[model samples]
Target: MYDEILLPVAPVGEANDAITHAVGLAERYDATVHVVSAADTAVDTLAGPRTGAFSERLVDAAEERVEAVTDELEAAGVETVGSVARGDPLEVIENAIEDGADIVVMPSHTRRGIRRLLLGSVTEKVIRVASVPVVTVPMAESEAEGERSDAAVDDVGGASGSR
Candidate 1:
């Protein structure tokens, strides 16, 4: 049902669950997956130049994040690639879709109230704008934390290999 899939990476701290979940979906669909960093879009651009150090730093960090994700996915034999850009989370994600994503697999932290109002809705925006489906894994910090055990994550017919 989907072709190219966009799996936006958050951080080792916040996104561990998202990555694991996205990987499962990618494997099931035999899709060419992209593990991109959402950091560039989360930065404070008004505080820095278009190509400023802050932006550079953000992209650099994102590069590292994507690299780690690529390592994980590639080891699993999932076809994976990555990229970065700056804008509203939804807009940047839409750009990824434009580049060739057919679906976006994301995890929601499920924050609500003033936080959602002030920061606006990213996944909501993606759903509204994307021509493709966006499958969101429920935010499960607890399960994610414990997923290192084999009982949790199913192998993507994956093998352990180096990045």
Candidate 2:
């Protein structure tokens, strides 16, 4: 039922699950995927040139994130295109949805207690505000273990090819 699927990539390990899920769903529906990497850049412009430099860094990272997902989808034979945007996370995603997303596929992390309350989820915010259907994927146990493994490897100055 999806003609245009929008998948937003987060700068975290959990995003792998969302990318995988989105690619699978897109393949099933033969839909073109619109991937977006959003960096929250609502900082005060009073920071002068430093603000511009910071925004550039965010955009660069976002582009890298988007490229990685697009490359994975392309390798899987799925049609995809992507863009990087700067704004509030929810607003950036909502703008993509309004552009032409039939549905949104995203991942949510398991946060609890004080952390969950303090940093409310972007996926939750998007779900609340998005006009289209939202598919929320949770990171699987195996994936979580893999992420831990990857982290351990990184801590010891090792490279992870899993991604």
Candidate 3:
């Protein structure tokens, strides 16, 4: 049912759950996984403030992220390849659609109430714009329950990359 899986690696938090899910799907369907991450925000600085040149920081960060994600997928016994590009999620995903990708498996991230209201969900943008079908993995029930605690910030919600 799926061809190429586009797994987006969120900056900092990473997409551990998405990779696991993608690996399982790829194994079942014998599909290729294309781990993609759109460079919407600058991937620089560990926290707090931006440091050094934008190009240097973004490229370094994106490269590291792409390598980590690809390595994780491969380590999980799934064949994978990926690219890091800068642009809007929907635009970049649509632009990166490879020849044999019939479906786009994305881990749509949640922006929460006001942020979502103001900026809109990246998944929403991709879904509205992507030419192929998209698969979304919402936050796990267990993860959601922990949101009320101090660990709330640790749980990154949803995964919506692309295929």
Computed on alpha carbons, the lDDT of every model, listed in order, comes to 0.59, 0.69, 0.59
User: How would you encode candidate 3's per-residue C-alpha lDDT over 18-128 as one tens digit per residue?
Assistant: 677788889998888987666554334335444335434454566677789898888888889877776545556677664456666655445467645654555676678
TM-score of each: 0.71, 0.81, 0.71
Cα deviation of 99, candidate 2, in Å: 0.9
Please estimate how well model 3 matches the true structure, expressed as its whole-model Cα lDDT: 0.59
TM-score of 2: 0.81
Rank all candidate structures by their lDDT, best first, as comma-separated numbers.
Answer: 2, 1, 3
Backbone clash pairs for candidate 1 read none
Q: Is 1 or 2 the stronger prediction by TM-score?
A: 2
User: In angstroms, how far off is 125's CA in candidate 2?
Assistant: 0.9
Q: What is the lDDT of residue 118 in candidate 2?
A: 62
Of candidates 3 and 1, the better by TM-score = 1
Collision pairs in model 2: none
* Best model per TM-score: 2
